[model samples]
Target: MYRNNKSNLKLMRLLPRIGVICCIALLLTAAGCSRVEKAEKDDKILIGLSLDSIVVERWQRELEILVATVNELDAEIDVQIANESIDKQTEQIQYLIDKNVDVLIVVPNDANAFYDVLSEAERSGIDVIAYDRLIMHPDVDLYVSFDNVEIGRGISQRLIDELKKKTVNIPEEEIKPFKLLIINGDPKDNNSKLLNEGIYASLQEYIDAGFVTVVDEAWANEWREKIAKDLVEKYLSSGEEIDGIIAANDVLATGAIEILSKWRKAGEVLVVSQDAELSACQRIVEKTQLATAYKPIYDLASTTAKIAVSMAKGEKIIANDSIYNGYDNIPYLKLDAYVVDLDNMDNVIVKSGFHRKEDIYRNINNGK
Candidate 1:
């Protein structure tokens, strides 16, 4: 009985220490579980892409490239196209915000219309990247696109050179001042304004010397082909003899060509185009258009994808240049644009794998 009493006293003394150790272990386990859950949440990121329109081939290609890149980085993306409708685009942006996306990439149809919604995105702690088209808001974090000024200069210079070449057949006395019609892009788009400025800059010397006459200048609403066609048709039927056209893009170029089809097929009118779209490439091959400005879509898309992924993960990004977007100098990644014509089309467009050789040469009798 004395030994049993002594053993009981020792057991009683250790019980409190045992209880204290168990309590500490339980608290530590709960903390560890909370950390694990947080790590899991950080592993998956959702990116929301609110595009203005996938109607253009360039946007469609961008969509594919972005999706592929996001998938490669093990991130999830939800894509929404607004069909160039500002109201629809705004609603889509709100929907993405409600879903709590980590990052938002936008190609706005109308730059001025995004101020309110983008402010909401900023309040929600979601970063916004202006893709291709600069969103003229202070809240936008980044802008990625080709150099619009250079593109405009490229297309205009090439068209001017081709017109000079075509004039060799005309006798100096018979060659009247070349009448050029200017078809500008949507006025709401900042890029279009820059492009127009560049085009005029390139032609300033020619205009001063009376080598070129500007018959008329018109803006294509939303860059719609029908609107562009109507504008060009009005001028074509106005009795002023037009010798060349400076179209803002492939879509606008196509619109003008529909009106100038009879003259273009006869090699009378020269048209300058942009976007390097497949249709434009075909037109170049067929000799219907003079040249198309080529901005490699792959590089733009892949870079955007990588940038979006990095920005979402809070990684540092290196921007080569910056552009002032109404308020501040926004970090920008601006690429250059090249003019593509039949002379070096094989070297730049085909060999670079921008377009398959077979596709560009489909209408040409010989592959070369």
Candidate 2:
């Protein structure tokens, strides 16, 4: 009984110390978990930007401006380039969705290809913004880009105006209808169809008047420069007389211009395209390309970033316009576009600091 009593006393004495040790360990573990939770709660807002492709120079500029704007707004951006592949873009979007991004911005390679994935994103509670190109899905929260129809109108009008200038001295009745070649962008892109609508609308009056004839027109696959080059080459090789070309964007314009150059007809054939890429601007100054439709990228990118941040924070977005995406109306915020040619290139492009004057005029004598 004495031994049993002694052992009981010893165990009793050690019980409080073991309890204290356990209490201390529990407190430490709780503190570690709290720290982790707090860190996660304080993480910066993450914006997932899925781009169709950065193959074009303008897209690089837009990316730089978007990153800068997002950083300025105290948010983090994750960019994924799809290289103009619909399947790849869809997969990238899924990855972003799995990452649980606060906001998802997509410059879709194919407007209609993301219906299922975008639906998945919405189901996951992620806000989707169709950047530059409209995603055909109705679940898209916002569509931010320039007025694409106006861009088409502006570039087409420029083509018509240039043709008018070339035949000014000749009588209207005696002048033959100018032969025009239309090299449109990827058919899968919604913007391309909208652009064609505007192009045909702008050219209707001229076409009715028998002033312009579309000799050959085709949609370039993936907006590939080589595809555009091949299209123009094939047309020229058939001995067809092409007086003007309406290239959908600068990349296509570059391809078309290359074929024209090979035929020693670069400046002789009037060509107009969209997206004021640096190379396109240089071509304009060199008289190889007549004009380009310049969408103010800084304004577009900054506005998109701000809207995206606002959407991420559950803030209300005020948009004056909305567009129907085949199912529902989506908030549309459009910016203006400008026509950039030699006459106003200095004022619009160089003055805006979009490109350096020296770089645009590098190939020209006396920087004319």
Candidate 3:
């Protein structure tokens, strides 16, 4: 009876304290609910962007722009890097789907290969924005990227200009032939295919005149430089007197330079490529490589970010240009690119802050 009485007294004392705590907890929970409801009402969207990979510098810049923009709007974004693999890309997209994001921005691993999964995702009410590379599925909501054919044509024409500079003009005498080693990006990427076609088209006149011959051509397995290195090495081992290399991007150009440095001939073999990366600019300064197409990474990345955010906010993004997506004339957010040589390397790349003048001239004139 004594123990029972003491327990009852303690319970009575705790009753008021317990009630206060319970009331406070209930108040806090209600407040949290109200805040959440308000936030939801204010249109703060959550976006999930799954990128193929950061093989080039542009992807990182795009991520920065997107992150900054979302923060400005009091929104959130989830970014995933697939490192250029379809399986990883699929997994990332699935995770985004599970999160119930307001928008899905994807630069598909293979634009044509993800139709089934994208359809499934669409069924769940996800707004899909095909980024950089066009996702060919009929259900894709938005498409954004630079003019791939124009990019290709620009680079090749720049190379032709460079060749003209190096050429010893003769009225009718046969010129010292310049053999080319063409290295394109992944065969599955439609953009890469278009770019290669442009390159070939630009070189057709030279090819017909017997001024250039593609000694060896290669396709990067996954738009990677290592594959390019392997292919370039194989070509070198074949004992072909390669005069110039036409790699599709800066990474491939770096890979080709690695193999070209071991050439059996006398002077540096001319190399041409795209994506004026810092290293590529440095190479140009040293004369180890000839030229690169400085695709305005800033413009594309910034524009993609703005378009993505606009899509999330339900804004207009009508494209100004059109590109042939195999059968259909697909619209595009076309941006311009420039060719970077030693002459304009500073003006084009360094001035844009893509590269530094000091770093580019770190080791020139055989200053190992």
Candidate 4:
């Protein structure tokens, strides 16, 4: 009984200390859990944006809008510009992958260059969105862009309509066929291919009927204005009369117009292009360029940003269309494009706040 009492006393004395130790451990565990919960709550979704290049004016605008939208959603974005280099773009993508970004948005310089790296991104459970330009990989989670084919058709139709108006008073058979020179975008870009398809499709009937002739068709590598200028210069120097030009975008249009200006044919030859760039809009109002296909950048950038955020949060995305990328059909969200000309330039470009009215007409106003 004495021994039992002694042992009981010892245990009783140690019981409070043991209880205190247990309490401290429990409190530490609770603090650790609380910190983990707080960290999780504070974690922001990180989206990686890999761009082909920001050389085009519209791309910089698009980036601004995208950044604004992403910030509005309380997410983060890592942007990398590859400057139209395929190898550099691949390196940037690998860097993004290593960063373990929750989502990746790519404006691919070349559609076919990202299969392996993008596949690795998917393997790591990251969602991928192809922005403006389509990635040829099947594993791309989504594609967001404007209707490029329609823009092509619309611009081509504008050129055709203008040419028709010029010869409206003459007999159809008496009118000579219009000679058209096509300055297409980078051949590596899938959008360029689609645009070319739409351009050819629109001109096919007129071509077959001997109403139009494609005098020369050239692809500008990397959509470089210098290359387009050189090509136009060569054609003009060869004594080939170019009645009209269908440049793939504003940059190419600028190049063509520069050469035409040197030949004193700026306003004489009808030129149409895409991307409602400020210079192109200015040219439209100045009677240098006929029209520009306006693809709303805010709509495209905002929608892409929202979709990227939703994807990062593991939310469902609803796409109204799909495009086959030579591997499999991927979800596509296409926006509309409008033709901006002298008639509706204010309504489309200015009204949307894409470009200020004064800025677009700066030169014309100054001349006046």
Which residue pairs clash within candidate 2? none
1-368, model 3: which lDDT tens digit per residue?
11244335435544565576556557678566665455345545678889898767767776787777767767788999998889888888999988867678888889787777777666666667777777877556666766666667767776667666666566546566677778898887777887888898888888888777777788887887888778777867887667777888888888778877766331267777887777888888877887888877667765666665665555555577665554455556667677778889878887888866777787874433
Tell me which of candidates 1 and 2 scores higher on lDDT: 2
lDDT of 4 at 8: 54
- What candidate 2 gets wrong by more than 4 Å, as runs, is 1-41, 366-368
Candidate with top TM-score is: 4
**Best-to-worst TM-score order:** 4, 2, 1, 3
* Model 2: lowest-lDDT 10 consecutive positions: 1-10
Tell me each candidate's TM-score.
0.87, 0.87, 0.82, 0.90
The regions of model 4 sitting more than 4 angstroms off are 1-37
Clashing residue pairs in all predictions, respectively, total: 0, 0, 0, 0
lDDT of 2 by residue, 197-304 (tens): 889989989999999999878898788778779878988898888888999999899989999999999999999989899999999998899999988899999999
Q: After superposition, how far is residue 17 of candidate 1 from its true place, in Å?
A: 35
